[model samples]
Target: MGVLLDSFGPALWLVLSPTNLVIMVLGIIAGTILGALPGFGAAQALALMFPFTFGMTPEAGVLFFIAIYAAAEYGGSIPAILIRTPGTSAAAITVLDGYPMARAGKASRALKISLYTGVVGSIASSFIFLFAASGLAWIGLQFGPSEMFAVGIFGLSVIGSFFGDSPVKGFVATGIGLFLAMIGSSGFSGLRFTFGQASLLDGMPLIVVIIGFLAMPEVFRLMAARRGDDPEVASLGGENREANHVGLKVMRKLVPTMVRSTLIGTAVGAIPGPGATVSSLLAYSEEKRFSKHPEKFGTGIDEGVAAPETANNAVVAGSLIPSLALGVPGSGAIAILLGLLISKGIVPGPLLFQQNGPLVMAVFAGLIVSAVLMLVVGIAGVRVFALVARVPRYMLAPFVLMLLVIGTYAYHNYAAHIVIAILIGAFAYWLETIRVPVIPIVLAFVMAPIIEANLNRAMVIHGGDLSFALTRPITLIILGLAVLSIVLGFFRARRARHESAAAKENLGETP
Candidate 1:
């Protein structure tokens, strides 16, 4: 504790240096713009900017990535609110209420809420990173293969059934995703499903899957839909000036939601593996469950926008906890940052503080500073971002398609990825046409490798005895939580379906 406190002053000096500050601001600006574009999320942004960090000092490079990482979380909400297109999968929850709020002539209000709550969540998370990263990382270290497998199962339960009315379709989608993840070489087997292509040897990249299933479908919809100018854009032109201001009364009402979501985000983020998306989904569900007007969650409510935005931004700093303290990358972007640290010959582990306290502290300081800068830049650029909604759908579709192609190709400079993305995008579009949820597929794909490898190792350790999980307390607890999550998700989906049926009947539509 004394060492951490002592390093704070030097950390501040390092972060506030002129070169670092410039890198911070530049990274934030670039991140915001790229994040506002569908298909170009934080991971993609970091991957694109990776080469630029080669010439920078380690502290400056870390600070630069931190700035972009935090700002992208805030920037993703911009498109989600104004156009119903989430720039990142984590921002998908924001679309449920953010777009509806914009339709109610309060686009500016929603943007302000997202900006403010995101800043609050990020700041709180930074403090957690500064004070408890090592402690949290130590807790993480206690998990063995079985515990991690159970954790992966718990994550699946939290996300799998939340989408689509039919649980069967969700299950099928998840099965397909797991199957996709199983392609590529295995330690026990030479090769399982990599036909003749060398590219499939590594399996499908998550970036390709994300772009195809999530972003490209939006592009297809934009190209196909024949809507006029958006109401959000018109509202921006003539809405009341005060609509942009989130006053004290509104802030007070949102305090509890922000607090709850911050805790959820930070805790989940420290666990590793799809933390941002999972945290946002969990926070949104929790807020809806806790609200007196639970049924009104997707109907342009302030809390809906606040919950997920806050959680996703909080994930930025929380994700760094494991990366800095345990040498474990919590997400794809953090993996890139971890690579940077390794390239710089900075090892992160139990002895990291003793060996590299100053640099780690600088990163801690940079997280908070970048969060504040995100708020500033987000507010200043809101008007310009809203202009995206005003672009003709015809023009917007091709531009977004161009971005999808470029981003996919840029991921590994592989042409095959572009073709695969287009194919998967078309398939995903067809799945949406049948009302099957894609969220389950994405969550399942991301978790499958972790679950498989961990389960395999656990089995090997226990001599293939499955009963050992019941004897391990932590594994039992996590599996219990997974079962509970599954039950809750089932009920939630059932209630939502019933409400949809009732609403349709009230409007004289067929069931």
Candidate 2:
């Protein structure tokens, strides 16, 4: 806590500098554009932009990416409002009220509501993150190897449980990631799965794997999608143009909904799974339940839009809590952020505040600035973002592919990395086709080394006695949590499947 206070001044200075501020604005603009495009999102944007950050100072890069992250959350609602297409998964809930509002000639109102609440949520969430992350870090500092290993296991279990409709598939994907992580030489054991390739000596490059899974597959999905004219965005109605500005009264009225949603988002995000998508869903449902006119939620109301939008944006900061404190990324986009930090030789976790206090503080400051700037940028360039949404997926595909190639190759200037990325990307696309979640794979891969290293250390200290973990209260608690998480995931999956089947059956009988 002292470290945070001591470094915050310098961190603020670094982030507020003119050069870094420019990076923040540009990143917000870029993120907003990409996020407003259907089928593109923060993870893809970050993956594509990875190479460009190589030349930046760590603080600047972190700030830039954080700006993109915050802006993308808001950007996602743009298409949801303008064209009834959710630009990101988190925005799907927004489509409920957003599209209806747009159809009713309230498109501007919906967008502004999303923008304003998103900024407020993000800023508020960042503050929660500031205190919460530091506290988590302090707790983590007390964890031994056994506890840390258990924590890692808990993270993977929770992530797997929440990833897809079926925990089975999610676990399978996690296994695949674990296998991929085992490819390099295990300092104690010789090469496990390198297959005699010298390049495998260092294991899979995080950059290449990240690009393959997050960026390339998106391009594949885009290009493989059936060719057609792009969906046209509905025009902003004349009345909407005349009354686009959201009055302060509307903002005042939705404050409670925004506050509730922000809290929900922060809590859920700190748990290391579910992320903005689930948070938004939960927030929207809760708001409906709390609303005076619940029936009007999907029919288009300010509260409906505010609730989900606020939650999803708040998730931008909330998701970082676990990532910064526990070295466990909450989502794929967060994995990218941690990957960058690692590449810069800045390890995340409890010690990070001690070793890189200023940098960590910079991240916190950057998040706040980005949240504020996202609102400004969103308001100024909304029309342009709406037009960008009209771009054909096919046209965007080639450019994205080019970026995938360039970014992958630039990481190490290794041609093999490009080939590996292509193969992994193709594999990822196949997995997607089978409804297998890719994010669990990324999370597990990122966590594998940490888990393995800690588990090995724990074993060495305990003379290979697994029973020692049973004696450690912290380790036992974490392991118990992991078990509970898996159980919960199984039930959630079963319930989701039942609900889906029922919905389909009802649809079939409707007409």
Which of the numbered candidates is closest to the native, going by highest lDDT? 1
Residue 98 lDDT (model 1): 88
Where in model 1 is the C-alpha error above 4 Å? 37-39, 82-85, 100-106, 184-201, 227-245, 493-511
- On the 0 to 100 scale, the lDDT of residue 452 in model 2 is 88
**Model 2 misplacement above 4 A:** 1-118, 129-137, 225-367, 461-463, 496-511
List model 2 lDDT by residue over 270-310, tens digit each: 75645777678668867875777754766888898999899
Error of model 1, residue 167, in angstroms: 3.5
For each candidate in turn, the TM-score is 0.88, 0.61
The TM-score leader among the candidates is 1
